[model samples]
Target: MFHVLGALVFTLVGVRDATWTTDGMAAALLVAGSIGVAGNVAYGFDSVHVALGDTSLVDQAGAAVLIKPLGLFFPLTMLLCAVAVRHVAPRWAAVVIGLSALAFPVANIGNIPALGVAVGVATVVGFGALAMRPVRSPSPATPAASAAG
Candidate 1:
């Protein structure tokens, strides 16, 4: 998913955030969210077969395992990623990422009188491009290192 790829851009930050807790938590949330998304899609497809009065107990179980991980874990992952990005990237990159995140959801309002989903998606693509730079944060200056150089 785009969100996960976007999150990976913050890996350097996640590892170097002066705390291992964030890195561990981000990894946990990423795995949980990914599993949740895969499972949700699997269950959703199975549940769809129940619509034509051809319900099976196994297929019907989709309703039970549907929303939790997707609703809870995925957003948490995004939040973690956003926080991670803030520490490593410039302020403007943070703003662009934030805008792109918001753009995805607003894109669903396709029939709105003024703006359309296309505009929203375009915003995400454009802003995401601006935000995703390849460089990691430069190492901090140390007296010995600076003197040596």
Candidate 2:
């Protein structure tokens, strides 16, 4: 769900000025979001199979297989945008983005999904900031008036 929202935000931001970094992030989110949706379906399917007294056909690993790639894509998404934000955003934002990028992959590693969720919220906020940031354009050169001799 978060990634889906992110994709929309990035797409809207892209309308202002498209960049390879932003466009690539949006594409990654789209792909990862699709995988997430399918993983969710697999999760539900596993549950249904268990409820129907037919656990033999369900591979518990299937859900993990589909969902675990998010551990890769989420951070990739964050870091990619982080590179763009590193210069434009405030120092604190840059620090947060960097730490978020490094920490996200491990947030859920130790059964700390609460931490993962918190990081996820931060990711959303970080992305929102990126999307809302005003674009930077080169300033036009103005010739100084020549002093009379």
lDDT comparing candidate 1 with the true structure: 0.44
TM-score of each: 0.41, 0.49
The true-versus-predicted C-alpha distance at residue 2 of model 1, in Å, is: 12
Which lDDT tens digits does candidate 2 get at residues 45-96?
Answer: 5456667887622344554555455335545555655654454555466567
How many clashing pairs in candidate 2?
A: 0
Best by TM-score: 2
TM for candidate 1 is 0.41
